[model samples]
Target chain A: MDLSGLFAQVLNGLQYGLLLFLISSGLTLIFGVMGVINLAHGSMFMIGAYLAYVIASLTGALWLALPLAVLGGLAMGAALEAGLFRRFYKREHLDQVLLTFALILLFEEARSAMLGNDFHAVPVPAILDFSVPVTAEFAYSAYRLAVLVVCLFVALLMFLGIERTRIGSAVRAAAEKPEMVDLLGLDARRIHLLVFAVGTALAMLAGALAAPLQSVYPNMGESFLIICFVVVVVGGVGSIAGAFWAALLIGLVDTLGKAYLPEIAGLVVYLLMAGVLLWRPSGLFAPGR
Target chain B: MTPPILEARGLQAGYGEGLVLRGVDIAVRPGEAIGLMGRNGMGKTTLIRTLLGQLPARAGQVLADGRDITREATFRRAQRGIAVVPEGRGVFASLSVMENLLLAARPDADGRTPWPLERVLTTFPRLAQRARNRGDQLSGGEQQMLAIGRALMTNPRLLILDEATEGLAPLLRDEIWRTIRTIREAGLACIVVDKTVGAVLSVVDRAEILVKGSLVWSGRPDALRADPELMHRHLGV
Candidate 1:
């Protein structure tokens, strides 16, 4: 490919990677720390996109929809945790998987019943609707670039929140030894709830941002969910840094693979994951704890 | 002497379908040191689990400061000043040493004294040296120290250490013993379980010997130590 075409693909990869990181980081955190494999995590992403679409449609303003989408995602995560996840905390992983899988079906059906099956698009704020010149004859959408920047900012904030604060320390402690966290007189259940909520909120934010770039259909997050799992698996189960780096690598591989892998005529993103797993069975950065 | 700070009466508990403790009774007076003695599979660990409410007691009552605590959640029991340095040290492997200590800090019942981070560091200098190290990084002895310090951070009225020094080197075992003595001197009641019967006997006010899933013998440390044959028969070397 030409230099400008390659540059555009790189940017696309970065944007896609950043969004995947936002969604998968939460999934990995919950999985690593709580050991709960929540199948409904993707539903949270879909709900975010739907909420953003609804809010943007009603208010005709993208900015007005973002917070609503995030809050809605948080509420949904908290409700699911309180009502179902809490009950399964002590249950086996198999049971948790079954229950959350059921939740995914329920959430998808509920979304269809409430919002209908029609595809929707969130309005890219007029400020970001313009295109920016990348090369003499090439241009990239300002909206996609803005989504990349916003996701990067969120990732930075999340990193800081996990690394620099007392709550972050508690979260790490809880993740490592929940029994110890409880013995320390801190309610581990509360920390689990907080992490789940935050993770869901991030997923929602990703969904909301992606709404402008793609159709906000009921099944929109289903595809992204599979991609997010690939991100989680490639990164490592519990390592945020792993998720970030892996997401970027996967994004690049996926974007470039779709564009360039046709020449080889057989390999795909799944092939790339298979290659990574062959080398590091636990993903590139397995959680040290 | 003050009706014992903690007491477990007629306790029976076990994992699903397989009972490990049967009608075990143990008590710890405020500022007193009690040693729990038993061979492997003799219900010492099970009794500790029952006392902490981690394993439900099939039958019995647990009391702390004269209040029935059998039905209280493990966290609730902890809030009432019962801290356990569980077997295997139970340190949060992912958290730094400082974070583990801080997680257990709670205000005293009268709200007079709190177990601050600095106090814990002072008590366990090894932990201070490795403050930033993750829980899993510490050696066995240091992990045990962290476990004790983690328990102390809650300012518990009664502290229970199950298998406190099972896998430590000789020097580290001596250090742990010194620390336990220091804690006892500070007026904190302790329930210590260890294989070193001679060492624990020298430190504790009383000792309870268990066989199978029941308390087989109970008396002053001197009484048990005087009978080496009795120790060998029940403890099996």
Candidate 2:
């Protein structure tokens, strides 16, 4: 492949990686802290895209739709936590998987009942609809580039929030020992609720961001959810930084592998996960856990 | 007419299908030190758990600072100035020692400065030296110190230490004991649970002995010390 082809692929990989990171970071936090393996996370992503489609069409303002989509996602997450997930916090992982899997089916059916089975699209804000030239014959969408920048900013913000803020410490501490966090005078239940809400919002944000780049459909989140599980496993269960790095690694591998090694592209990310697991057992960067 | 900072009467709790603490009673006034002694499986730790609301109290009451906290969640009890250095330390293994300490550092329940970070570091100098290390990386003794430091950082009105020096070396055990004494001198209510009855008895104002999940005896340390047979009858291995 030529340099421009490589450059375009790299951009594709990064943009895809950021999206995966946005979604998977939430998955990691929920699983790591609350010990819930939510099978419906991808459903939240699908819901985000669908919400953006609905809201943008109604308001004719992409900016307004995005925040509303996030708020919508947060409400959905809180509802899921209070209504269903809360009952399963102390249950076994097997039970959680089954419950969350049921949720995925429930959400998909709900979406179909509300919006029907037809595909939908989100409007690309007119300003970002332009493109920047990569090579003599190649150009990349400015919208995708903007996603890369926005996701990076969000990632940085999330990292600092968890690492530097008092609430962040409570989050980290709660994941380790929920009762112990209570012993420290912070309500573990409140932290769990907050984390579930945030995780859900992040998934929705990714969905909203990705809607302009792809067709929004009922099952669009299925593949991304699988990809997110891969990212979480390869990044370590509870580490956000791990998710960030692993998401990029998987994104680049999947994007470039499909381009250059089309014959075996489908197997590259799984292979990388296996290799990392064989080496570390845990993912590459979970510090003490 | 001030109530005890922590008072439990006929508190009953246990693991699923296996009762551990059967109607245990204990009390601690402000700035008082108490020793809890019992053999393995006798439910000393279970009593602590029930008192802190970590376990559901099957019967009886837990009053803290004159408030009945029997139905309160564990964290709410903690916010009311209940802190514990639980068995196994329960340190945040993924965080640095400093982070572990800071995670629980806040003003006491009354919003007064008590054991600040600087004070905790000064109290446990080894923790200061290893502040940058992760919880899992600390020596068992250091982890114990960090645990106590973490609890103290909360500036709790009542601090409970369960087997604070269980696996430490001789020197470290002494160091832990010394720190416990220092904390007592600093005027904090503390409950020290240890198998070494003599060490615990020496420091505490009052002592209680448990047998088969029931309190068999309780009194000032001098009364227990005066009767050597009491130790052999209740605490002897």
Candidate 3:
């Protein structure tokens, strides 16, 4: 491929990877810290996209829709956590997986009932609709660049929050030594609820941000769901930094493979995961088991 | 006699159908130090877990500061001035040493000041050198000190330490025992579990020996020291 084309593909990979990181970081936190395998997390992304679509259509502004979609995600996450997820804390992983998988169908059906099965789209905010030229024949969309910047900022915030703050310390402690955290006077249950809500909100935020780039459909989350699991597994189960690196790698490989090796493009990400797993069964940066 | 700060009345608990603490009764008054002694699997740890609400009491009551706290959550119990260093140190491996210490620092319900960061640093100068390090990075002795320091930060009325000096070198164990003496002198109520009878006996005012999930002896430390055969039978030491 040409230099400009390669550069554009690289940018695309970074953008894709960052978006995957947005969703996977939350997934890993929920899994690693709380030990809940929530297969329905992708549905939150779908719901966020749908919420963005509805809000943008109603208000005719991306700015308003974004915040509303975030609130929508937060509310959904909190409600689900208190009502359903809280009950499963002591249950086995098999039960958690089965319950969360069932939630996927429940959310999909609920969305269909409310919005029908028709595809929907969100218009790119006019400010980011334009593009800057990379070369004589190539220009990268400014909206994609904006997505990259925003997702990067979010990832940085999450990293700082987990690494530098007292709340983050408690969350980390709850993951490793929950009883100790309790003995230290912090309610592990409250921390857990917050993690679940924040995790769900993050998945939604990624979906809302991707709404303009991808069509919003009832089952649109299914494909992204599998890819996200790959990102989390490759990044290390609960490591935030690991997810960031793994997402970028997967995004670049998937994007470049599709552009340069069309026939085997679909096989590239799985091959990468397989290679990494062979080298490190616990993923690249997983904490000692 | 002073009203006990912590009292377990016929506490019964276990794991999945196998009873571990069979009607164990114990009490700790304010500013008292107790050395809980037993051989392996005699329910020394189980009693502690039950007191902290980590294990559900199959039957009986745990009264904290004259209030029945049997139904309170573990964190609530901590809020009420109860803390445990725990058997495994239970450090947050993902967090920094400073963060672990800070996270546990909170005033008790009566608004008494918790252990200041400076105090912990002074008490454990080695911890001061490794404040920025993660919990997992610390050596076993440092981790033990951190555990005790973390519990102290809570300004607890009752401090529980299980296996406080397990798997440490003799020097490290000596340091831990000396620290326990200092804490006792500081007038905090403490329940300590250790295999070394002599070391624990030095700090605690009284001793309780458990055998086959039952308290076989509860008396002054010197009283137990006077009867070596009692220690031999219950503690196998």
Candidate 4:
């Protein structure tokens, strides 16, 4: 590839990595602290994209739909936690997987029933429709850049929230030693609910941002979900920083591979993940030790 | 002079089909220390589980501060001033020492009894040096101290320590006993489970010995200490 092409591919990788980080961070948080393997997490992303599509169409402003989509995601996540995930907190991991997988089916069907199976588009705001010239003949879309900036901001906020605040301390405690968190007279169940909501909200935000870049459809989140798991696994389960770095790595590898390794692109990410596991079975950034 | 701070009446509990605690009854008065003694698999741990509501009491009552707490969740029971330093320390291996202590600290109504970071450090000086260390990073002795310190942070009316010093070195075990004495002297009701008959006899006011999931003997610690054969038969120590 030429210089400008390589630089463009690199930016694409960064943008994609940031989005993956947004989604995987929440998944890692829920899994690390609550130990709940929520297979339905991707469904929440799909719900966000659909919500953004509906809101943007109704309001005729993409920016106006962002917060609404996030709120919807939070509500859906909290409801799922209180009604379904809470019951499975102490159950086996296999059961949690099965239940959440069932939720994916339910979510897809519900979306179809409510929003129909037609593909939807989230138009970029008119002001951000143009591309910024990086070189004499090369450019990147302003909307995609905006998504990158917003994702980075949220990622920073999440890091601060988990590492600095009193609530974050409680979350870290609960994630590490749930029983001890209970012994402290804190309502761990409430903490779990909050974490689930926050995680879902982040996923929603990612979906909403990606709506303009990708078509909104019932199955849009499924492919992203698989890649997000790869992000989680390669980064190390439950490590936000790990997710951040791994997302970038995966983004670059996947983007560059797809750009260059047309025939073998599909095998590239899996090969990278297998190599990571071979070196560090747990992950590149396993949290506990 | 006052009603027992905690009591269990006719408590029966088990794991699966095998009964572990059969009609076990125990009580702890304010400012008193009681020791639970039994050989391996004699239901001492089971009794602790039933009392904490971690294991369901099939047919009995658990009361905290004269209030019926049989139906209360474990966290609710904790909110009502009951704290447990569980067996094996139960430290969150991934959490920092300060984080573990902070999680267990409860703010009093006036917020004066808060177990501040400094107070915890002072209580367990070892924790001070390793405040940023994860639970799994600490030695067995340090983890036990952290467990006790974590429970103390809750400002609980009743503290229960299950196997408080099971795997510690002799010197560390002595330090734990000294700390228990200090806590009891501070007027907190405590129930301790330990295999060291001598140390337990020295610290607790009363002792209960369990055999085959039944409390076969209950009396003043002196009464049991006077009969070494009793200790050997039931406690094997």
Candidate 5:
């Protein structure tokens, strides 16, 4: 591979990893704090993509769809948590899995009923559609670079939101000991609701951003969901930092493997997960809380 | 003479089939200090859990400031000016000392933030030194202090301490006792549970003995100290 090719591949890997981070971070958080196994999370991503498509088609602007998707995701997440997830907090993992899996069906059915099964492409915003010149001989895709910038910015915000802020500490503390959170006059249910809502919004946001890259379809989220699971497992069940590093590693491995060795590209991400699990069972950053 | 800050009446609860708290009744008045003392495997922890609404009351009612809160959630009870430093300290192992305190900082029903960040940090100099260290990294004494500080941060009218000085050096234990005295002197209602009978007696105004999931005896601490036979029979002190 040439220098520009390598650079482009690296950029693509980072972009892919960051997107994975956005989705899996929510998965890990919900699992870590609420001990929920949200299989339907991918459905939320799909819904976001569809939301992007509909809004973009109507407004002819991708930017306008972003905020609406986020707000909708938050409302949907909070509703799901209040109406469904909190009830399953103490239930068995199998029940949670079944519940969320059922939600995926319900969500997909609603999507099919509302919009019909079809693939739709979102237009890249006109402002960001033009590529910046990196060198005399080559220029990268402007939309992809914009994705990198947006994902990185979101990741930074997540880090600050969960690490530096008081609410972040509450979330972390609740993950360790929810009863303590209750005893501290902070409702654990509210914390769980907050986490769920944020997770949903981030998933939707990731989907809306990627709508331009990978045309929206009926079950695009299934693939992303599986990859997110791999990221969560490789990172650790409930560690945000773990999800981040794991996402980047998997992204690079999967992307580069596809580019260099397409024959076994599908097996590489799973192989990495297995290797990591064999080394550290719980995950890379599960602080024994 | 004022109404009790917390009152539990006929609270019966247990794990599965084994009943641990059997019709346990206790009350803490404003500015009162209580010592709930019992040997291991008794209902000392159970009663605290039930009172805090962590466990459901199978039989009767739990009232906070004269309002029924038996069906309320634990955090709701906490929001009503009740706080507990539960057994094992109940500190968030993932959070730092400062974070632990900050997470619990809430105004009481009167909307008075009595125990602000600065006040709590000043109350526990050891916690102040280790503000940025995670809960698991702290020693037992520090954990206890952090728990107390965290509870105080809620500006609770009533605070409950379970196993206040279980595993600590003599100096640390004395410090804890001193802090309890200060809390009592500040006119906050408190429930202190400890194995150290002398230390608990020194800080608490009233001593209640738990025997087989019930309040076996309740009297002034000075009276209990004078009666070693009663102490041996109930608290095994």
Candidate 6:
């Protein structure tokens, strides 16, 4: 690959990883704090794309669609936690799997009924349509750069929110010992609700942001779902920072692998996961001493 | 007699068909210290769990400050100024000493900040030195102190300490017992469950004994000491 091509691929890897982090950060938290395996996380992303597509088409603007998608995700997450995930927190993993899997079908059917199973595309906001002149002959796509900036901004906000605030500490505390949180009289339900809602909104936001990059279609959530689980496991079951770095590493490996070693691309990310597990079974940033 | 700030009447609870607390009843008046004593599997912890609303009372009621709180959630009970430094220390292992203390810090019901972070850190100067260390990094004695300090941060009117000094060295255990005495002296109502019979007797105003999930005895600590046969029969200490 040429110098510019390598740089573009590296950027592509970072962008892809950031997007994965947006989604996997939620996945790890929902699993870590709430102890609920949210198999439908990718569906949040898929729904975001569909929401983006619908909104962009209706209002002819992606910006308005973004906030609406976020709002929709938050409400959706809150509703799901209250109605479904709340009850399943203590249930066996088999039951949780059944519940979330049912949700995937429900979402897919609803998507088909509401938007039809047709492939759709969201137009990039006209403002970000141009490229930055990195080199005279080679430049970076402004849209991809914008996605990277937005993802990083969100990541920074999440870092500050989870690390610097009282609620953030409580969430971290809950992730370690939920019953203890309740014993402290901190209302574990509210914490769970907050974590779930935020997780859902994040996944959806990732999807909404990615809609222009990757066209939307039926079961689009399924494609990202397994990879997200990988990210969650490799990052550590409940560590957000772990998920962040792990997602980036996976993204670079997957993107660069496909770019450079096409035939073995599919095998590399899993190999990385295997390697990480072999080295640190709990995860890269496991919670304890 | 003063009305109990916390009370459990006929608390019948257990795990999945095996009853642990069979018709157990206990109460703690304002600023009263209680030693809930028993051997292993005698439902001492179960009774505490039921009072805190972590375990449901199958056929009884829990009242807080004379109000029925049987149906209240655990956090709601905490909002009412009930806090437990549960068994196993229950510290947030991944969180720093400061974070764990600050996470649950709040003004009491009447908008009082009696147990702020500064006061708590002062109380446990050992904790002050290790404010940035994670909970798991603390020694057993330090973890127990952190748990108590964290509970104090809530400005709880009533604090429960299950296994307050379960697995500490003799010196650390002495340190915890001193702290517990200090907490009781600071005018906080407390429920302490510990295997150290002599230590428990020294601190609590009243001693309540459980045997096979029933409150078989309750009286002054001296009264408990007078009945060695009773202690040998129930406590096995």
- Over the stretch A177-251, how does candidate 5's per-residue lDDT look in tens digits? 877888888878778999999999999999998999888998889999999999999888777888889899888
Ranking by lDDT: 6, 5, 2, 3, 4, 1
TM-score of the candidate numbered 4? 0.93
Largest lDDT belongs to which candidate? 6
Off by over 4 Å in 1: A134-138, A263-267, A275-281, A287-289
- lDDT assessment of candidate 3: 0.87
RMSD of each: 2.2, 2.2, 1.7, 2.3, 2.1, 1.9
Chain A TM-score, cand. 1: 0.93
Error of 2 at A29 (Å): 0.8
Winner on TM-score (4 vs 6): 6
* lDDT (tens digit, per residue) of candidate 6 on B99-145: 99988888999999998888898899999999999888989889999
TM-score of 2: 0.94
CAPRI band for model 5:
medium
What local lDDT does model 6 show for residue B81? 92
Q: Give chain B TM-scores in order.
A: 0.95, 0.96, 0.97, 0.94, 0.96, 0.97
Residue B97 CA displacement from its true place in model 4, Å: 1.8
B39-106 per-residue lDDT for model 1 (tens digits): 98888888887887788889989988878989877878788788899889898776788877776677
lDDT: worst 10-residue window of model 5 chain B: B92-101
Ranked candidates (DockQ, high to low): 6, 3, 2, 5, 4, 1
Off by over 4 Å in 3: A135-137, A287-289
Give a tens-digit lDDT track for model 6, residues A122-229. Answer: 889999999998887789989999999999999999999988898999888888888888888787889899999999999999999999998899999988988888
- Among incorrect, acceptable, medium and high, the docking class of model 2 is medium
Q: Model 3: per-residue lDDT, tens digit, A22-105?
A: 889889888877899889999988988887888788877776656766677778888998999989989999999999989999
Best by DockQ: 6
TM-score, one value per model:
0.94, 0.94, 0.96, 0.93, 0.94, 0.95
